[model samples]
Target: MVTAKPSLELVAEVLNGHPRSISRLISRVEARDPECRPALAQIYEHTGRAHLIGITGVPGSGKSTLVRELALAARKTDRTIGIIAIDPSSPFSGGAILGDRIRMNELTGDPGIFIRSMATRGALGGLARASMDAVDLLDAAGFDMILLETVGVGQDEVDIVQAAHTTVVVSAPGLGDDVQAMKAGLLEISDIHVVSKCDRADANKTIIDLKAMLSLGLRMNSTTGWQPPVVRTSAEAKEGIDELLAAIDRHREHLQHSGELAQRRRRTAEMRMLKTAEDILRARFISRDDDIVVDLVERVITRALDPYTAALNLLATLDEGKSDDGGKKRP
Candidate 1:
């Protein structure tokens, strides 16, 4: 059994290139445990070096394929690749695909590629936080490029993209609703727009439509310097990948030289850490005691208390709990 200290030591060892330790460390972090906190802290300290790239679009838009292509390109430069794919919660079955690894098996033999599947636990609770932690873990593992491919649900696109250094929004050729379906904030969040399945006949039309939509955004975000580029690609044919990689490089360069990258990183770090702190407070101090939790739940459910009121009560309980325990609580 790996003790907490040893486990973190092992994680650091894995970050230096030990594959077995890497797998074990990932498993340890992904599991549910209050004890994982220390390891997470060490991992967080080791991060900020990896370039996190988020990719998202509507379902069936071929996002994963594009990510796979990008992985190959990153590998050519001897970069260690980390992939986090969000398999959304199935509305009916409450299940997730959790199966993309089979399709991207070409990366299996390569020691440079580390891929993991994240189940979007639920509507408000899933995807956002778990995905962030998973990326941080990958970053600490010393991956050069961490590619995050998300299930393209319409809402929350902006929040997800904000977690990364760069974002690529993928769309397929004849997706029909390209212009009307894309979100307004998409243009602001995404660093690049990719029209996948470029071999398809309607790809050019999709490009034209996206360009038209971008023109409509000039009133709001036109002063952001470089315009977001639309790159066409065929993941299956393996065409245009080099250009896409170059485009990503260009965006990274622009962000770095323009002093925008530091600002983005600062904002991301602040939000992530604040969110995590809130979640910890919710789980430990507010929800730890049965009577206080039940009271808050009943208040909310019975409509005797609205959400804000309930939150206030919970915070009060948390404060009382802290005062009682004096910040000492065993896991």
Candidate 2:
């Protein structure tokens, strides 16, 4: 029987590109296990070298298939790829419903590719809370490229922009009203647009409509000076995958040349900081002693205290608890 390695040793093994160690670290992160923190802290210094790309779109956009094709195309260039495929959660178990192991089975035997399936777990913005943490682990493990595929929840996918250096939005033909849904929010956040399943005759309509919309709006982030290009891809025919990769490469080059990469990195850091803080506060709020909030809840329930005042009062109790503990926070 083999004993488990310590966290630091596991981090060392992961950095040395041990696949099993990398998977174990990601598992700990997804479980939100406290033991994972030290390894994550060590991993952070080795990150920022990997190119993180986010792929998002509505349901039936063939995102999984497109991702598989993109990975295959990218591997031809000899680049190691790490894929985080976010699937909808199982209502009963809160686990990923469609695992990457099944969806991307063809790529399983490749040594250069690593795919992880994470459940959205009811998280808004189409990503799991632990998704970025998994990305960090992969980045630290020396992967050249990381592809983050969201849960295909349209409009709520804006979070991908905050998490990735480049965001690709996939659009499919004959999605009925889903195309209109893109006009509402997803269109504004895409760095590159892809019309998947272009083998279908109706695909031209989607390509034309997307291009026209791009023309209407500058479709360019003023900072990056990039006009999002629509690339047509047919997984069945294996066409346009190379062009899509080229578009992504061009966007990365533009970001580097225009110095927008540094700015985007800074914004990503700030957003992550704020989001982490919100999570911490929410956890503390939920874990607070029941006795402390019961009175406040009763007061608000009876209209003796306004909800706003009761909320303030609850915060005051937290402050008091902190003071009593010599400024250290309680679990």
Off by over 4 Å in 2: 1-4, 90-93, 219-223, 327-329
lDDT by residue for model 2 (34-65), tens: 67788799999999999999999998798888
lDDT tens readout by residue for model 1, 1-331: 4435456467567557566665566566555466666777777788888888888877778887888888999899888899988877777887767876766788878878988887765634225456777787778778999988876656445666657788888878777775566755555577888889999887888888888887777577666686888898997788988998998889889888889899888888887888777666755754364577787788899999998988888777766766888866423
Which candidate number has the best lDDT?
2
TM-score of each: 0.90, 0.93
The local distance difference test score of model 1 is 0.76
Residue 149's lDDT in candidate 1: 81
Q: lDDT, candidate 2, residue 227?
A: 85
